[model samples]
Target: MFCNKMLELQRVYRQASLLALITIYYNLLEGAVSVWFGAGDETISLFGFGIDSFVEVISGVGIWHMVRRLGRGETADRDPFERQALRITGGAFYLLTAGLIATASASLFQGHQPQTTRWGIVISLISIVSMQALIHFKTKVGTALNSPAILADAACTRTCLRLSVVLLAASLGFQLTGIGSLDAVGSLIIAVLSFWEGREAFEKARGLGCGCSCGCTTSTKSDH
Candidate 1:
């Protein structure tokens, strides 16, 4: 009976590891596509969203590492590598935020308009569906394993979902009204959220416990 339980635990851990890997790879693809299309279409919101995905890749790598350690029956405490990843992720997010804010401000000031927001609409729709599915599966696995780290990662994905929604709204609004400022406004919102995520990453790295907007504090407490 005990051996059966152990095998089950291993299987669940493997599933968690697989999910983390999927998140990392998916973000890479999404980021690349978003950046390419965003640049082609001159959509600041989509471009900023793509950069955000790249930052998420860094965070996803840390989650993958944590899963590996936990699979080995190690403690959930943030290790040196995870801490470093968090710091890097935080810095990247901050940089992205600043860039987006600056670019968005300039675009607004110049009354710059995107060539097209159709791609933004398409990308955001896909992201919404993908993030929702990931959240569902991650939450299921986290719950089954009673793993706070996994749950926290799942919570983090919600921020991605929110970004998608913002992108979609801005894209759709611009498409309907032929208003260019909508895109810049969306980029500004993304910058605000990215700034918040950066702060959360730094806090996590410092072992301050989760005060993330994603409501992960309840689950993350177990990690501390």
Candidate 2:
């Protein structure tokens, strides 16, 4: 029974690690594609969304490290490496927020429109489906392991899901209505959410909860 239990736990840990890696790689691909098309098409929202994915890669690294430690049965406390990664991720998110806000405001002021939002429509749909699947699996694995860090990571993915929805709506709205400001409007919304994410990252670095509904904060407290 003991050996079987250990084997089962090992399997869960491997799944968690694989999920983390998938997230990192997927973000890299998504970020590259999004930035390339966003820049070519001059779509602020898609551009900003791409930047967000890059930042997420940094955070995913920390999660990957944590999963490795947990697999070894190490203490679940926030390690220095994870803390530093969170700090860097937080700063990157803040910078992204500022840049997006500035560009979006300018675009709004000038009534600038993208050449076409067709790519945004396609990319956002893909992101929406991908993020949803990631969230479900991450949450499931986190539950199996009872790991707050993993659960919080799942919650963070929810932000990506929301961003995808915003992009999709703005892209579709513009395609249907020929409104130039919808894309900028979507960028502004993404900026706001990015700011919130930045704050959450900092909070996590400081040993506080991410303030998401995932109950990670409560779980962290209980662990102590």
Candidate 3:
């Protein structure tokens, strides 16, 4: 029975590592493309979305390291690193929220109209489909593995899905209506959501329960 448990855990770790690597590569590509097109078109929402992707890369790499540590049987050394990652994730979100607010405000007030980019639509569509797939698989794996960190990471991925929706709506709205301010409005929404997520992540890291309905981070055991 002990041997069987060890094997099961090893399998979970392997799966986690694979998922983390996929996330890293996907985010890097998505971030690069979004940033490129967002800058070219001066769309605050796409630019912010691109920044979020890069932040997710950091998160994915952190998860990869945690999984590797688990594989190496170094469970005792994981808590501090997990805490730090949570803190960093929270901090990044706060910064992103602030930037989005400033940029969105400027766009709104300065009559900064954005041109429609074919790439924004393409990126948002790809992200929506891809992130949804990832959330499904990652949530399944995390539940099966009984890992809080993996579950938290899955939750984070869900937020990405929401962001993709906002991006798509903003991009499509602008493309269809020619209302350039729609992009800025969408960016403000993203900022509000990001701020909420950041506060939750930061609270969970401090052992203050994330307030998620799932109670995923109610305990001080671990977080992502």
Which candidate leads in lDDT? 1
Lowest-lDDT window of 10 residues in candidate 1? Answer: 210-219
Candidate 3: minimum summed lDDT over ten consecutive residues — where?
211-220
The order of the candidates by TM-score, greatest first, is 1, 2, 3
User: Which rank order by lDDT, best down to worst?
Assistant: 1, 2, 3
Task: State the lDDT of candidate 2 residue by residue for 1-224, as single tens digits.
Answer: 99898899889889989998999999999999999999999999999999999998998898889888888888877789989988998899899999999999999999899988999999999999999999999889888877776787788788889989999999898999989899999999989888888888888888788422222454442131
RMSD of 2: 2.2
Question: Would you list the C-alpha lDDT of every candidate in the order shown?
Answer: 0.89, 0.86, 0.77
Ranked by lDDT, the better of candidates 1 and 2 is 1
Task: Enumerate residue pairs that collide in model 3.
Answer: none
| Per-residue lDDT of model 1, residues 29-58, tens digit only | 999999999999999999999999999999
Determine which window of 10 residues in candidate 2 has minimal summed lDDT: 213-222
TM-score of decoy 3: 0.86
Tell me the tens digit of each residue's lDDT in model 3 across 12-50.
778878987998999999999899899998888898889
Cα RMSD to the true fold for all candidates:
1.9, 2.2, 3.3
